[model samples]
Target: MQQAPAKDRIQLVDALRGFALLGIFLANILIFSGWEFLTDAGRAALADASAIDWQHRFHKFFVDGKFYTLFSMLFGAGFALQLERLTQRGADGLRIYRRRVLILLGIGLVHQWLIWDGDILVLYALMGLILPAFHRLSDRALLAWSALLIFAVPIAGVLTVNAAGWPPDAGLLALSERVAVALGAVNPQDGVTWLRRTDFDGWFSWVMSGPIYSWGIRLMSWRIFKVLGIMLLGMWIGRRVASGSLLNDRRLLWRVLAGGLLIGVPANVAYTYGKQWQTDWPSLIGTVPLALAYAAAFALAWPRAQRVLGIFSFPGRMALTNYLTQSIICILVFYGFGLGQVGYWPPAAFYTFALAVFLVQLLLSRWWLRHHAQGPMEALWRRGTYSGRVTRAAAPG
Candidate 1:
């Protein structure tokens, strides 16, 4: 595997990644803290119900669906950068890229089975397989295809399901029943109960059994298309970055930032309220714009706020490690076998806790990079990609 030298690393991208990680942690903590599992009645029963209600609204509007999109785009950008470098070296880029992706898939599987059920790496790896096909497409073509996947497909599916009353087959229902049985839960309530009361063994068993069925459902629902579309957009951005146009184009950045905010803010508000009301259209339509706006805002601020934003680059540089570490830490904190503090804290407390955890991670990441070139998981990924012949590139500056 060809690694970018530390000097060549894009600090802005790393910072954006680091920033995305923070957002992801904030978002995931809802599930990790079991706040997501609480029923509307349960939430209403909280002593800080008013605060929780507003906090949740804020989260749904600003946090949910936005950071993951950013991260996916970054993944595509990384793919673009790697493919370009490989081609420049006249190597068999496709073969090497496939090997790298396969390794990532393996890592993702292990993570999903052993760590967190909300893992995105598996989906990223799965979606990544199709990215090579788009590599040869023009930038305009890439954007066009991305918009089709992101907007058209999902909208069509929603319309079809609503209009035709799509039904779950008996086999799918049986599989879900089997999954629940495997996790020692017979229904949604039982599942939440099991999640709250189970020991390490039971929890591990749930992780092993649940994600399989969950992934199947996601696939059936066509979530992969949205993810793929975002990745393609990332690839387009990466190409611009590689060409040195995106970094220098202040006017373009301003336009993107302005447009993203103007459109994204209201759309996300609609998405938030729509979700509360169980409407799907706003979320499907709003996620990409808000996510893009966030990216544009970050890019515009990076140059002026380097001293502050640059701190994020440490965690961003070892994002794989940080991401996995977050799952492990959250599991330990919230799962029954550990602290078992799930569903106890208010939304505000969880937000503070997420920030605290990320701060610690930032420090740990900085320290680890001082001695090693990359995070442990990244090292393992590189080794697997290179068939045990990995080179130790210097850490990002």
Candidate 2:
């Protein structure tokens, strides 16, 4: 087999990635700024909804489950692309990918410690460890395992609830209350300070002193499984589209969306309805279907959206640098590390800030790419992968 040229990287796929990056940032702003716990009046636009504490309701309807699901699905696609390249070169793709995941694990740990505890990179790294093992499974097998694994944790949780019932385990409940209380006590303006303490002392304490018992039980639970399932779906999409086989398939694109909506909308709605039952089973069952819908919708969106959202391509091209930059900016704006405007900025305000960041990134990324081969992080990653073949890009003067 002829080796694929290095310059053959697809622009449309990068554009799609950038679009997913933007969606991720929008959903993440709430968690980044600590607005996830704020009162409805503190953020919502609707007066009646705010009065009734409709924050979760609104988030669920829009950002909550949707954007992150898109992001995770993209990761899966990315993995497939990577493996395809390695396989074409007759290299051990799994071995190479594991090294990369190890590197990511280290990066994620640093990110969580110095930046934010909500870092998904760490989760991705942990999940990536098991992914290469599933590379060759038939699509149906992949889908089945994806569904089963995604639901397993939540189902187990539901079963535990059935067995134990009511207000949670006494010991766990007490610990959760303590953690919640500490988190609640921090004023928004003190977010930067919170970051330092939590990222450092809090993280260290949890890693060293937290029970192995908890980790053992929850490590492969539903949340992790759902993400893994998404990654698997992404692998399928990446193999199909990133490989350039689907670009000319215009009819396939519409079919993708129609099928996704047919399956996704009803599944997501059913999942939402199940949530109203106030039990774990309904949510678990509902989430299983919604996960499938999310994968389909994203795959369907890409080829169709490319021509429409081509401009976002550059930012997606530099995703690593941009993702890290977001953390840096948040630390500067909300923490004592810089301006420390945490609690003062409501959730709605983050949307404005996010827009500003996006605009700046979109312009800067395009500008940088005009004069450079790759983003700084991509260059560094290349240097890591190729040994001495290339040098890291120097920081801008």
Candidate 3:
């Protein structure tokens, strides 16, 4: 809710966030549409197998988990930046952050239950608590821990999933299945009525299955390791940015750009074609490097591309509002309560929808920012964050 002056604002960060929002939409629409439910034959019939398969490769290479990685990094950077302001003002950053996280947790739960199951806010809120622990660490020590956290668990998980579909123990598998079954199955009859045709019964089915389908399979499956690590890495980068080490070193940026392209490209290519055991696991881990490549590429280009890419600052500025609105728009478009066209659209067509929606959001954001300083959700979050805090003059001398 606190607005920075235009001159002081970091346009590149906003641009990166805006870019990531678009990418997140592209990455997420697949699951939201229930597209995975399509039969192999059904998918083939919808489009030429080669064309559809190529689309899959395109997603894997450029889209897939990359945006979320960028988003998470930005989250860490934002937190670090806020801590600096809080420090200068002699405010307790941890206390303010705790309130902010709580507010986010409440909003995230509401979002998850009503709009979309693929919510990251709840997880971010949970992980934000852990960040204070790192705030006092030396830069080198922080980076070391960040690297270990980001790569170790995910790599191990991938290897485990590749060798055996994770939780390799028969007893554990059976227990998890029992828990999942107890939660319920996502038997939506078909993709058409899954959201549209559902009366109370249909709604109830999804609600019940949320634990298994949404939380268990979605969160516990792999996202935890990925999210936690990326956040830590983001925080580490945040510190560097705070100290001016990251932005000042063009050589470092070049190294990252080169490494991201040189290393990330082939890793993504392998990820696209390889099966679960061979390349799938590695691909998941590779998303981070590729995402970094994207950030570096954009940062390098932003100076030249400002007018063209600067447009991203709109949606990026009101990210939370826009993010939630995306789910609302999607629900209205694809669910039975609305249009119910969920899986009816092909991949290319879905991409068009995402782009169109984002464009509209951009225009709306522009209009809103012209009238008001903060997005509605952001305003509420800020109020909560600063609630009951003593004013500077009121503090002890």
Candidate-wise lDDT, in order: 0.79, 0.62, 0.72
Rank order (by lDDT, best first): 1, 3, 2
Of 2 and 3, the candidate ahead on TM-score is 3
lDDT of 2: 0.62
After superposition on all C-alphas, the RMSD of every candidate to the true structure, in Å, is: 3.9, 6.2, 4.3
Residues forming the 10-long window of minimal summed lDDT in candidate 3: 388-397
Q: Is candidate 1 or candidate 3 better by TM-score?
A: 1
Runs in model 2 lying further than 4 Å from the true structure: 1-9, 40-58, 165-221, 242-256, 266-307, 388-397
Please count the clashing residue pairs in each candidate, in the order shown: 0, 9, 2
- The estimated TM-scores of all candidates read 0.91, 0.75, 0.88
RMSD of 3: 4.3
Best-performing candidate as measured by TM-score: 1
lDDT of 1 by residue, 199-291 (tens): 555675568666765575565555788889999999998888876777678788888888877877787787655345222666777777888
